[model samples]
Target: MAFVILKDLAYQYPSSTGLVLENISLQIQEGEFVSIIGPNGAGKSTLCYALAGFVPHFFKGEISGEVEVDGRKSSESTLDEWALNVGLAFQNPFNQISGAKYTVFEEIAFGLENIGVPRDEMKKRVEDAMSLTGISDLADRSPYSLSGGQQQRVALTSILVMRPRLLVLDEPTSQMDPVGTREVFGVVRKMAEEGMTVVMVEHKVEWIANFADRVIALKDGQILIEGKPNEVLTSDLLIENGFGISRYTSAAREARKRGLWKKEKLPVTLDEAVEGFKS
Candidate 1:
């Protein structure tokens, strides 16, 4: 079933004269891990805001066409109402953290409490969320005192505590180091494995190309190409759209130049590239 749907969607800011998104149409199914990649201003974030009900509600914009989450129209819903179903994690983790005085556990439980989940249920949910994000050890620490990676994890746990059906991550690992980036991606993959639909906007093609079930490339506020990671990452269309091929894919291409790998299918990961070498 389609968990989120967009049809001819476009958004125009009040102050700007042009559309941020132009004629976008796509459907994301339940429990799919998809990545949206593009240059800086390719409407990637605009699409995220539109699907999360932030464009028309929070930003002063003119919206056309239709956006639906689980068959519910986005225009008919408020940000607060939609937030229960869609969890958004921004690129800057520090901007999302609130209540600096609260311990990590309290921060995670705060949203659940506001939604009127019972006390016992809230406790279980908080614990489960922290565990899933690997932040159970930091539950008693203050958000300000934790490392940048830990803070990001806490922010993620807060969202996970809400038990959202769709998780929208906007460069959630953009600010992290190599280790932290792996940590954030690990958590994201685990959530997807557990049946949560994940739509991420990321610039790190190498990492996402290996894990994302589907990859969509955008250019100048429009989708340029989309398909399985191997297919989309290897296409000339992606290069034309300003998306770099994954390192492994590039290596495979280089190997093909040397006649080491005769296979026509491109590799999307280092493991696949190594396997190609063996073949």
Candidate 2:
């Protein structure tokens, strides 16, 4: 079943004179992990908000066409109702922290509390979420006192505990070191493996190649290309349009140009690059 559907969607912010998204349309089936990649200002974040019911609801912008997630249309669904079905975690984790919560544990629990989850169940959910994100040790600390990467993990855990049917992440690890990045990505990938749907906007092509079931390349607020991860990531069109390619993909492309790469298809990860060259 399609968990997310967008048809001919376009948007312009209240104060903006131009369209931020142009005729965007796509459908994400339940349990699919879709990765969106584009340079800054490509409207990736705006699309994330649309999926989470913030574009027309919270932003009060000019939105044309339709956006439906989990069978609820964004044009009509209330933000509160959408929140129960779609969770959004954006890049700047600090912006996501609720100023009302004092401790990290309390902050992660804030969402559950608002939805009237029982105290005992909420406690168990929060603890399990923290453990999944590897933040169990920091649960007692003040969320504000944590580093940017730590706070990002906390924000992710908050969304995870809610168990939204669809999770939209916009560069959720933009501030993290490699290890932290991998840990967070692993947690979300596992969520998808367990039947949750995900749409993530990220610049890290390598990670996307490894875990994303599909990759969507956005440029100038439009979807330039989208398909299976390897196909979209290794496309010459993607490279020409200034979308960042994996380092391995770039190297393989170069080797092909120099008649050193034997494979017809380029590699998008270190392992694939090594194996392709070995053949």
Candidate 3:
């Protein structure tokens, strides 16, 4: 069985007339990195909430079907219990900052302190996570005083310190620049390689194409396509449906039509495009 499984999952908010997520079913293997992409209001964030056990547990909504992670069902577990094995980072880092902490180190250590992790162990974990995200220098700074990208890194570090089995990220690098984005993606890729299952909602097609093990495209609260990143990120269907795609894919498509590109598959990353164009 897969490490993460969602079977016929559907959810609706109290104020909404229709389901926010419908007929969603997916299986993710242990240590796999899956990326979700779609336009606004596609329910991508809602799906992340469901995976992290906040859909019904915290959102107070109608949720049907199963969300099982490592044999424990979200429906059966309390939010606190489910949170131990799943960590979620929001798109906006400000939403994650805890005002109670005076320093970034304390902010990142809050989760560990909550579960009564030993003081020494918590410090070590927080320090390790900070270093991994390249935020060790910001350890003493106030969380509120940092820039958007810096805060995003701190938020991600906070989640990383928990060492969750599954990590759910909703545009975690949205506030970062190119260098920061690459660093964050590298850290996430490393985490997946080290046996963490990851589900990320992001619009950075090139990075997703280069790093994610699989791609799932959502539209209007339903999955429109699912496949390898090379196929999904370059699919014409994505363009037809108004879904975001890699710019290299777009350029390669146009070049192909002009008989300037002869590749059987379109490129989704800069390197692929350069190689194909040079051929």
Candidate 1, run of 10 with poorest lDDT: 93-102
Off by over 4 Å in 3: none
Best by TM-score: 3
Error of 3 at 42 (Å): 0.5
**What is the Cα-based lDDT of residue 194 in candidate 1?**
89
Per-model CA lDDT versus the true structure: 0.84, 0.91, 0.94
Write the residue-wise lDDT of candidate 3 on 1-279 in tens digits. 899999999999888999999999999999999999999999999999999988988888899999999998999999999999999998889998988999999999999999999999999999999999999999999999999999999999999999999999999999899999999999999999999999999999999988999999999999999999999988888999998877788888888899999989899999999999999
Winner on lDDT (2 vs 3)? 3
- Which runs in model 2 stand beyond 4 Å of their true positions? none
lDDT of 2 by residue, 1-279 (tens): 588999999999998889999999999999899999988888999999988888989899899999998777888879998899999997788888999998999999999999999999999999999988999999899999999889999988899999999999989999899988887778889999998999999998989888889999999989999999899999999878888888899988889889989898899988999999999
Give me the displacement of residue 246 in model 1, in angstroms: 1.8
Model 1 regions lying over 4 Å from their true place: 177-180, 258-261
Q: Please, what is the TM-score per model?
A: 0.91, 0.98, 0.99
